[model samples]
Target: MLKVNKLNKSFGENKVLNDISFELKSGEIGVLLGKSGTGKTTILRCINGLEEFDRGEITVDDISIKNVKDINKIRNKTGMVFQNFNLFPHMSVLENIIQAPISVAKISKEEAVNTAKKLLKLVDLEDKINSYPFELSGGQKQRVAIARACALTPKVLCFDEPTSALDAESIKKVINIINELKNKKIAILIITHDIGFANEIGDKIINI
Candidate 1:
């Protein structure tokens, strides 16, 4: 579960997020909808501890981001999928997926690979396990990124502009993949300017 209460963030004299409040329960999809410069991505960054907020609180599975010591604790339980599909160009799909579990979670390589395979299959990227990032299409790369994020078995998943730079068919695939994750009871948070995409999958829509 994810909860953001009275959140506020600012860059010097410019305030970005103002009293942003929302709660996402297990198996629910929450979308933050707004145009560019509305601090949608900033909220996600604050939730993941990538950015320090000026005020308020973000609780992911009851672990508050406000606590300095618990930052890594919450981050381990959270996964983020960026807009550009941030995959390692030199690393193969299998390697990318297993990296976090092995390095951060301290899981064995054998176990991590097994989990990676399952996640790759979930994202329909099993066949591309040996392929490099450059060899895949945008949609394929996005799926790979999703598989990598899910490899950690995170409690909360955050996606930034998930449907960006994809065709209609690709968007449909993403929708299906997100729905599958939701069925598995992972709390999902997404920020996008696409109203149609939000309406299609979001259980709760928060406007900025």
Candidate 2:
């Protein structure tokens, strides 16, 4: 579960997020819909501890982001899929998926590989295990990114403009992947301007 209360964020004189408040519960998909520069991604960043908020509170599964001594603990529980697939250009798809689990989750390489393979299958990227980011299509790369995020077994997953870089068909694939994730009971937060995509998957839509 994720909750944001009266969340306010600003950069110098510019106020990005204004009293934004919402809650996302397990097995539910929450959508943040607004035009560009409305701080949808900022809300995700603050929740992930990637950006510090000036005011308000964020908690993931009841753990306060502000009070957490080890931010990595919060990050481990919250997985973020960036607008651009932030895959390692040099790493293979399999490698990318396994990296976080082995390094951050302290799982064995053999175990991580096994889990990564399963996740790849879930995202329909098992066939491209050895492929690099450059060799993959936009859809394949996004699937890999999703696989990488799911590898951590996060309680909540945040996707920032997931369909922004894809074609119509690719967008469908990504949406299907997201739809599948709902059955896993993980809270999902999607930040996007794509109303059709949001309506298709969102259990609750929060307009910013």
Candidate 3:
């Protein structure tokens, strides 16, 4: 469902990604691993159209993105979760998820709420619907973030060190949630420092 060829990205003088090439079919669990400064996160941002590349091509489901015109189209097929939860503190959990669908997905408010609730249940957070992001623990907040991402129901789920800030218990819980998503046939790409989890959960690992 995703193809990245000769992808090169640099930040002025620093080169992060060097001719990276990879292909992901539907339902595949792929992992990208490297040192702290490598282009792992940048690669994900590029795929989701958050970071523009210096060169190379990225295709999601045969749709090529080389200009601003295809940015939204490519992003609609991809959901990215950052190391930081990046949740809006002022918004409630349900509001965080529902807003995206109603505004970006263009679904009706009622429809978006219904879908958001179902997603919360998938992440086992149905009871915390009315909770604000600050009201939840790191793991709970991360799960809410995951639920929000899944609410998009994108073709691919890209996670960047999702459990980095969580405790041991929280990390395990997050891993379990990701495993479940993998089983449910969501294409998963994780850029993480958790090598053990990568070995256990990833179908393929690319170490830069």
Q: What's the TM-score of every candidate structure?
A: 0.96, 0.95, 0.95
Model 3: per-residue lDDT, tens digit, 1-208?
7888888888999988889999887788898999988888888888888888888888887888765346887788889887887998999999999988888889999999999988888788999999999899888888988988888788889999886888988787787888888777778889889888888788999887
The local distance difference test score of each candidate is: 0.90, 0.87, 0.85
Candidate order by lDDT, decreasing, is 1, 2, 3
lDDT (Cα, tens digit) per residue for candidate 2, span 45-127: 88877887877777787776553244665788899898897999989999999998998889999999999989988888888
Model 1, TM vs. native: 0.96
Worst 10 residues of 2 by lDDT: 64-73
Scored by lDDT, model 3 comes in at 0.85
Q: The CA-based lDDT of model 2 is what?
A: 0.87
Report the number of the highest-lDDT candidate: 1
Tell me the deviation in Å of residue 5 in model 3: 0.8
Which residue pairs in candidate 3 have backbone atoms (N, alpha carbon, C) closer than 3 angstroms, thus clashing? none
lDDT of 3 at 141: 87
- Give the residue spans of candidate 3 off by over 4 A: none
